[model samples]
Target: MSDDLPLTAEDVAEIAAILEHSGFRELDLSTRRFRLRVAKGDGAQDGLTQEWQWAGASGEIAADVAGVQADPAAICSPLPGTFYRSPQPGAPPFVNAGDTVGEETVIGIIETMKLMNPVHAGRSGTIAEIFITDGTLVTKGQALVRLA
Candidate 1:
């Protein structure tokens, strides 16, 4: 996370590690601009077992579970921010439903404070659905697109 951001990637990792080592089933944290919830799962419910990993050099948090593959169809936000489907006002969106995209394709952009971060597809697929409207606020790990 940026120094200006409320939470850092290390903060999230520490929280997750604490939750995983404790008897508590879940943890929820909230701030003026961000919210995070982590819960233990029993092999049911989509996204219930998501684990956070710290990207040391980049200061980014990745959602993953050991030995478990992430759902390829859903493209989620890396952090809490205002999501923008188009590059700018009155511009065409980066991708649309039925559009084929590569793993590194830029599907949308998330604006946090004044920093604009590009959101990638992460896996190659055809866009199936868009879950958020342009310029809507999105939370970290919130699904923004579904692939076919």
Candidate 2:
């Protein structure tokens, strides 16, 4: 939650509205000031517990119209490393929300053992969300981005 893009209650509602038919099973976004988790109503069908956590808040949608919250494909880290969302500081991020990426698209970098390794999209789809910010410490298999 940057002051530049303040997350509001309306934004939460809007995100929930978007979740209704976004073809995504679940959507998770967290920032300094906002943490949101939206899941489909019948999430238990997948055998995943519908536990939720966000800034001391939790919820589940009971509406059948929005109960199909399935998880979108996530680009995860392969090794523990420093995650960089851009090639370098003062540079544009490799990808942003709504950006289309291919299986071979380089979305970011993971620096391990002082080596910067490029991270690929691993799948072809629009980048619906990004989880890690620039220069964060990411662990192996941590969800980095959500693809639709």
Candidate 3:
């Protein structure tokens, strides 16, 4: 009998806690013009449920505008692994702020399960920023660079 009612804040909080402990990445809820989503891992999108009938096409347009795009400054990983910006321990990093990089330039290395995978620049541009630090874990599609 109670299943038809909307969820309370306490219920949502408990669900979030459970999702966090279970290693799930996301959860979503939607009703008419209202929608909610929670991401437990790295704050990336994990789930989505939409009530399309209430908002119509305008909501879809808004969602499309908010989507992320691939850019030249985007330094995608060569493989899934730990990312290191330097060539060796205690050495200066290969690139720094404002350094110009070509498409073939190696920006970092990704260590996957004992194998070293070299990461490269996808396009030529000035190094606007570095997103990850040395010895940090990285996943596929994670941004590692910003270009001018």
Q: Per-prediction TM-score, please?
A: 0.54, 0.52, 0.52
Clashing pairs in 3: none
Better of 1 and 3 by TM-score: 1
The model with the greatest lDDT is: 1
Q: Model 3: residues >4 Å from true position, as ranges? A: 1-72
RMSD of every prediction: 11.5, 13.2, 11.9
> Candidate 1 lDDT, tens digit per residue, 1-148?
4434556654554455455546888886544445566776665643334333333434434364322333567898776668999999999999999999998999999876556889999889899999999989776667899999
- Per residue, candidate 2 scores C-alpha lDDT tens digits across 86-130 of 999999999999999999999999876566889999889999999
Worst 10 residues of 3 by lDDT: 60-69
Give each model's whole-structure lDDT.
0.71, 0.68, 0.62
Top candidate by TM-score: 1
In model 3, state the lDDT of residue 33. 52
lDDT of 3 by residue, 53-140 (tens): 2335445311211123456557765444578998889998888879999988888887765657678786788998888899997655
Query: What lDDT score is found at residue 44 in candidate 3?
Result: 55
